[model samples]
Target: MVTRIAKCTCGQLQITVEGEPLGVGVCHCFACQSRTGSVFAALAAFGPGYRVTGRATDYVRTGDQGAKFRFRFCPVCGTNLFHTEEGEDNRSVGVAVGAFADPDFPPPRDSVYDCRRHRWVQLPEGITVYDKDPE
Candidate 1:
């Protein structure tokens, strides 16, 4: 099993997860863009086999489809390190792929909300593209 460490810019918050992510994807929703200050947000999802360290601040928001998410960020640096879907029984978590700062980190396998994706932005080949979040 491979272990990965993702941390905030200020190093105040971190998460350690064992093994590869269940899925890696990118989101182009306006909310994601706003949260990341980028055209899109890339994240890796992990199961319960993970541990979190340090302190973080939470900002809860509802998605377009009405699913609520609790985004966690470093209090010192305000780095949006991770987020979790609310009302779900599973303890799955989505960690910002950029937080790892690993140049070789895996590319996103899925792309959501392509309608909102920037016109100049092009995804890699062989990726699953969705006009919107799949139901």
Candidate 2:
């Protein structure tokens, strides 16, 4: 029953994750890399009970999954806060692992789009990996 709080760099937007995440994963897809300005994007998925408050701006993008994802970010500091997929439960949310800024937060359970992962990047042993989304 660990409760975690994730906020934008400016702390204008915040997300409260109740309990543990349903899943955590890293995305190595080009889109994710570009969005995060990094080699990959780590995300923590909270269940339907999570709560997010504060101002955010969002844009829709079609993911490789063929589903549209509404990506939300903090308007003040331009931090990627959370996103929800089309046809998915609105209450369920995915937030940036960096936002939590907590070393104790859960680690990614798997790596997706591993085919696109950088050659020098090493992942932890035994964690499940997929060339693409497990879905």
Predicted model with the maximum lDDT: 1
**Per-residue lDDT tens digits of candidate 2, residues 18-120?**
8888898899999999999999999998887777889999989998769899999999999998999878855688989999988877778899999999989
Residue 61 lDDT (model 1): 99
Full-model lDDT, candidate 1: 0.94
Model 2 residue 133 distance off true place after TM-score fit, in angstroms: 1.4
State the RMSD for candidate 2.
Answer: 1.2
**Least accurate stretch of 10 residues (summed lDDT) in model 2?**
84-93
| TM-score of candidate 2 versus the correct structure, residues matched by position | 0.95
Q: lDDT by residue for model 1 over 57-88, one digit each (tens)?
A: 99999998899999999999999999999988
- Over 4 Å off in model 2, which ranges? none
Clashing pairs in 1: none
lDDT of model 2 at residue 122? 93
